[model samples]
Target: MSTEIELPPGDQSLLLVDDDKAFLTRLERAMQKRGFSVRSADTVADGLAAVEADPPAYAVVDLRLEDGNGLDIVSALHSRRPDARAVVLTGYGNIATAVTAVKLGAVDYLSKPADADDVINALLATGEAPPAPPDNPMSADRVRWEHIQRVYELCERNVSETARRLNMHRRTLQRILAKRAPR
Candidate 1:
């Protein structure tokens, strides 16, 4: 059981970019439900192409994609439409990347598992005040899981390489990576 946020209707266009197909689809539907004219891409290149063709009024981009980092999308969006309000989402959040996201023109940085309401608020809020901090932040175990997944992705999903990079036994890394992310 979930309650939906009611956002006022608008003609503004929005772009959603994430490598995870299910997450991207869910975000697209949620954004559309909230009255945004939403467009989605699952790769950085496609997202950049969309931005080049027509910059959106708002954007929600993942920090990492299969082909490249989502920051590239933000940069392209910036060049095409400097006023576009972009938010960067990541499962592996860190201060350095958050700062880089903002520097690249993202208005907000959100960790993964952000709900539709959070994303909408970030996209549409006027610059008066910041949104409230997340009530339930990721736990330490969740953070560790996210980090392992990120390392695996960065290694092109190569188990041995990721294990070597993470300095863990290959079997241990495999077992850890195989489990679903913790809540």
Candidate 2:
């Protein structure tokens, strides 16, 4: 069975920015089906350019992009269109980053794997009430593993550099990265 997402009635365009090509493509289609006119960018440069050319009414930005942080995109969106609503999605969640995202004008910070429904709800929020917290938050181990993966990617998948930055043995970091993400 398939469920259809119903977005609020309007012709508002949404911008989706993520470095993962597959994810960006899939999300663009999903958002379109939900009734949004979607614009997608797979890099920070492209995202910023899209925002400059045409600021979207809403935006879903990945926290990490190939060229720069997703927060940069949010900041640009906010500057161009202060009323625009934005959400930040990240695989690696932490308090500091979450606060930073909000201060940069993201309406909400969501962990990755957020479905189309979740993104819509976040964007359409009235800002009068905070959304309910997740029923199941990430376990500490899961958070750790996600952080390691984020660092790994930031280092361009160089085990030595990732290990050095994390201050851990290269083999240990490698083993952790090799395993599937913790539940």
Candidate 3:
């Protein structure tokens, strides 16, 4: 079955900013197949340059990049083209960052590994109604695990710092970190 989404008549230019070369290439190809004039950048600097040169009508930006955060690109795009539709994609998804993305004019905030169809739908959605719930929402255990993992990463993977920040016992945090992520 075709996953292509028909975009409304307008400028179909799309800017995709991601650090993962493989993911960027795959998403670029997929978006092109779906009829977008796709432009991709693997770093925040390149992404900002693309936005300055010519802001696209749509954007799918990774929240984290090698040089800087992708939110910078999103901010620049919105400033250049207020009407542009932007979606922030991140592996470390959190409510605070999602709110910030929306405040900075992103149309949506999606977790990493989002498919082309999901990105397209988020870009084209009219915002007249709330988005439908995920078909397979993360379980509570998974959510907790993800949060802990995010915290651990933000703490520079220092178990002591992460545990202290989380108000969790060091041994407990270590145990959780050692276990595989919950589905």
Candidate 4:
């Protein structure tokens, strides 16, 4: 005697768009385990095409795509498939972007390094759907401060080495650091 076995797929499918290969692979596995059949595209164009053809129940899109920006994808998705839910993932992590993504059609947005579980939770929290970090995490002032601190700690503060390494100006950097040093 012989037996035949088959498994039924879940009703909810997901589209994941990101340029990071490792992130996409890992997310694919995780989402699959969570009963979501995930389709991945490294570029926004491909994602748009997939969505057009298949129209998944949900989409996890990156803010930055290889071929084009993810914002464009979000806009298109919102305009084309109003029924589908979407979430935007980004590294820039700014409030403006998050708001824009939502206004465009994403249900919510989250920053990079967000875990699969967290992402799943966020999607669930959205009940459908998809900013930036506060003020450039690496602002010019922060850069100047760090550059000076590092240079001083090394006891050299050599303009050439510090500036060259940081791709900044030896003189300009020095001036910035000096401007903030309790003077």
Overall local distance difference test of candidate 2: 0.87
Q: Ten residues in a row with the worst lDDT in model 3? A: 1-10
Best-fitting candidate, scored by TM-score? 1
lDDT of 1 by residue, 1-183 (tens): 234556555547999999889988988897777678999999998999999898998999999787989999998998899989999999878899999999999999988878887887787777899776656667899978878887888789999999999899999997887788888
Against the reference, the lDDT scores of all candidates come to 0.86, 0.87, 0.91, 0.73
Clashing pairs in 2: none
Candidate that beats the other on TM-score, 2 or 4, i.e. the better one: 2
By lDDT, the candidates rank as: 3, 2, 1, 4
Q: Report clashes for each candidate as comma-separated counts.
A: 0, 0, 0, 12
Give the residue spans of candidate 4 off by over 4 A: 1-10, 126-183
RMSD of each: 2.8, 2.9, 3.0, 11.3
Q: Model 2, 48: alpha-carbon shift in Å?
A: 2.4
Per-residue lDDT of candidate 2, residues 1-183 (tens digit): 124546666647999999888888988998887788989989999999999999999999999886889999999999999989999999878999999999999999988877776777788878788875555667889878878887888889999999999999999997898899999
TM-score, every prediction: 0.79, 0.78, 0.78, 0.64
TM-score (C-alpha) between model 3 and the true structure: 0.78
Better of 1 and 4 by lDDT: 1
Deviating ranges (above 4 Å) for candidate 3: 1-4, 20-26, 64-66, 90-100, 111-115
- Which ranges of candidate 1 are over 4 A from the true structure? 1-10, 156-159, 170-181
